[model samples]
Target: MERLKKLMVGLILLCLFISCSQKNNKSDGKLKVVTTTTMLTDLVKTIGGDKVVVTGLMGEGIDPHLYRASAGDVDKLSKADVIIYGGLHLEGKMAEIFEKLPELGKQVLNVGESLDKSKIHFIQENTPDPHVWFNTDLWETEAKAVTKKLSEMDVKNSGYYNQNYEKYKKELERLGEYITNRIKEIPKNSRVLVTAHDAFGYYGEKFGLEVKAIQGVSTDSETGTKNILELANFIVQRNIKAIFVESSVPKKSIEALQEAVKSKGSEVKIGGELYSDSLGDKEHNTDTYIKMVKANTDVIVDALK
Candidate 1:
């Protein structure tokens, strides 16, 4: 019933946003942009350049799957000239908030909405995986979408956005190649990625690894003791040397699996922390999206090798 109420409220908000009587009259100096994740915030800042001011709701080590907007966050959204987010329920709890923004005349855009529906991988019948940024090529698509949207918003700086997009595209192409070649260093059978949650489905599909997670697509999904014991059994049977913990997810999940492995007289190590829903801290190399992928790849390859 509560979920039904939320959906109904979202529907009403969508109607208001699409055909609402109110809207911002014109550009008031620089466009004030608010984003849901650090990746979107970074991309907009990179492409929007000097044309906009960006605010990101979630930071490094924060889980978007578990994040809820505070009253202050609501105030920030209310004042935003443009709102952006990684859609496809990446900001799952904030669906109604996004629905209401469009009605308020804010330019709200979801990064995932730009992708062709057929191309996105569906984990469970019709449930599209929202972690598109894991695959660099797909992430490039999001980057291009940001470029086009920024161009439309700040026509004067369209050229700048295009230039930045071109440069970033080349860099992404290189990053994709880097991940591909680096992955080759590991033998095929060892190319399995086990993490706390199934966030790496897109990464595995694109980069050629079999992914396993105790939790479902969302971190909020219920994980049972049976599932954990079964996954631990699979790891021991397959002789997978290491499983990983996610930066955003609780380590206890993976730790439980490790304990299960030990109960069967087998040993498995926690590979290393992988960035699932969040980026690494500023002092580390994974402060940026591209760098984060590289960091994860290195950890994965090193552990598996």
Candidate 2:
């Protein structure tokens, strides 16, 4: 089945390359940008503005770790003038496809790879955490990188892109302040952020919370009974008020953890669903990257405070 899938992708790539070759210029006179995660999509859109057309492969509530690129996604990517993604294997299943795109002469940017290595958190040797967006300061770095990429691709509108970035930078600064103040509301001992997965490492590190998760960095990682029992014990001992469920991951593991805590004669509430891997839609007021971060912080602070 893996071989067949590869063959299909290969055939699709060939056809897309041919079709893309025939299109010498975009009729709309805008750079066509394709991004993997919603975070990158928002970044591109925020910087590119009217100068570029952006297409995001992943949507709200989608988990990038387990997201396999469909043929339709490949088609979109192959035709793009530039492709941006959160690298470090965040989009694990689509990594091979991303690798092949550059071979076909597509301009690709791995946002995570462009970061200063010293600022990154590694789960172990060479396994850097891909949840860098949760750290507002780190995310500002990514925003600057995205702005530079957009400017390079659309030189005519380089000034416009930089302008947008400067404006966005101020907003991010305000967001940083907001997060710091909100985090202060929670008592130091109660600043433990227990979630469904280890996606909040950056958030915890930046905001001074002790983050614990039932699963590892990737949602694809297994959640064994031993993991549940161990986490339950920690929660009980810490007297954690609430645990969070991720929008992209199933709540079963976290629900199971709550049950284990109950078995230990302790109680915990489900704080709220966090937008870890994806942003929420407009209905939830988390459609934009800034909004999503604010929403998640509000949820975490309210629960723990």
Candidate 3:
């Protein structure tokens, strides 16, 4: 009986020790960083290396424009050691909430906000374009800014951040080259990108394509029959091969245009859904900015070619 009691006591102590060790391991893991978009989260993951645990608040195909911060999201934000957002009012309704995060003493990094004011094209003079990721070269600058913020947050991991940032920058440069080469495959005059909205302006500017949309920059912009008719007419007149539907926005607008074009005896194919305002599934390659751009390029090439 005495031996059995001793064995039980040893087992209990072992279990307690294991439990405490797991708790400490979790505590020592890394600083929790939450980003508004998958692109930002991926970049943070690269720069932060093993020193940060990054998560995207927006999930696959989730529209940042229409996104509302849920109670669970708030709880996530509250627990984060640092939060990163694409800024430039990309979050739309959630903008005010993010603006208040710094007031709560949480380190908030608005990486796009560091862009040169002169380079940014705004919906209004005060509101900058949030689609910086579309311009891969420009995104490098944003990544550097993010790297700086990560270093500031965890100075001990500064060396790792710097090393990783350099590696990430090279990858971005490679992606830019690949996009340039792929876009070149499209006939010069056929290089027109028409979508539900003006989300691809940066993309067009970067890749030498003419871009047009029925709605303006914001998905919240109202569309009317006249706008639909106008876009259909333009598509038919230009003989553009494809029009893309955004993953976040409704397809009704694009469908209306397609029907209008068909009535005019011109058939413009609907290009596969594009990841404009959000990333692809986390398990997929397009879940990050680099992969998102590559996915878009592939779809665009397939449709246009």
Candidate 4:
């Protein structure tokens, strides 16, 4: 009954938005792109440059996994020239809405879904991890995909988009090198990353860290007492120097794990907040994708070293 009611409300909003968009068909002569996560927003802005006006539905510290599209979000999406999102169920609650957008004639790009299946990491037999941005190589591929989409949509500005992508690609290469070097500062055994959730699996695999978490990939997943206890024991057994809290996930689970560590006669520090599912704001110097990843690397290296 609840799902039906929500669906009805969405349909009504979609109709109203479509009507309003048709009535006010004023063009700024730029492609209006709607992105689901801040990461994608930054990517589009970096590649699209002055050619696209990008609006991000999820802002800094917003968890995409638990994010549901509001009426305003639906309206924004309905009016977009193109909609791009991190697929692989990253935006768990908004999956249905994304599916319906293409049916409404909206050009939609599922960045994660466009990747080669072999490159994606599967946490379970069939469930692939959605946090591909952590792997710089994979993120470079996603950036290329975005460039291709923007060029296809705005052929006149294809050259401009390609140029921006080439420049940004070099920046990403530098960022990858920086991450690899910074991660090496930590001793091999001490390179273990303990976090509130399993969002850093890609980061761990990419940079050679062993990652453990009290919760699963999605923040919507529950954290049981047993899970917390087990993670705490692992931390104690490994003598991990520091654990991390995610910008979008609650700190309580990590805090509880800290208490469990204490009960087991070991201590662990909350290293620093890592930008897992979202980026930090400008005030924190992590507004851009490169800055966010660099800031996270600095935090991790500083804490674990």
The prediction achieving the highest lDDT against the true structure is: 2
Local distance difference test, candidate 4: 0.89
TM-score (C-alpha, index-matched) for candidate 3: 0.88
Runs in model 4 deviating more than 4 A are 5-17, 20-26
lDDT of 1 by residue, 1-305 (tens): 88886776565454444444446444657878889888888888887878788899888889898887775576567667778899887888887678667657678888899988876888778677898899888889999998888889888889998999999999999999999999899889999999998899889988899999999889989889999999999998999999999988889999999999999999999989999898887788888888899999999999997
Per-candidate local distance difference test = 0.85, 0.90, 0.81, 0.89
Provide the TM-score for each candidate, comma-separated.
Answer: 0.91, 0.96, 0.88, 0.95
Colliding pairs, model 4: none
Kindly list the per-residue Cα lDDT of model 2 for residues 44-80, writing each as its tens digit.
8998888889999998889999998777886787678
Q: Which digits, one per residue and each the tens of the lDDT, describe model 3 over residues 134-166?
A: 988788898899888888877888888989989
Q: Give the lowest summed-lDDT range of ten residues in model 1.
A: 17-26
Compare candidates 1 and 4 on lDDT and give the better one.
Answer: 4
Better of 3 and 4 by TM-score: 4
Root-mean-square deviation of Cα positions for candidate 1 versus the true structure, in angstroms: 3.1
Q: After superposition, how far is residue 292 of candidate 4 from its true place, in Å?
A: 0.5
lDDT of 3 at 300: 92
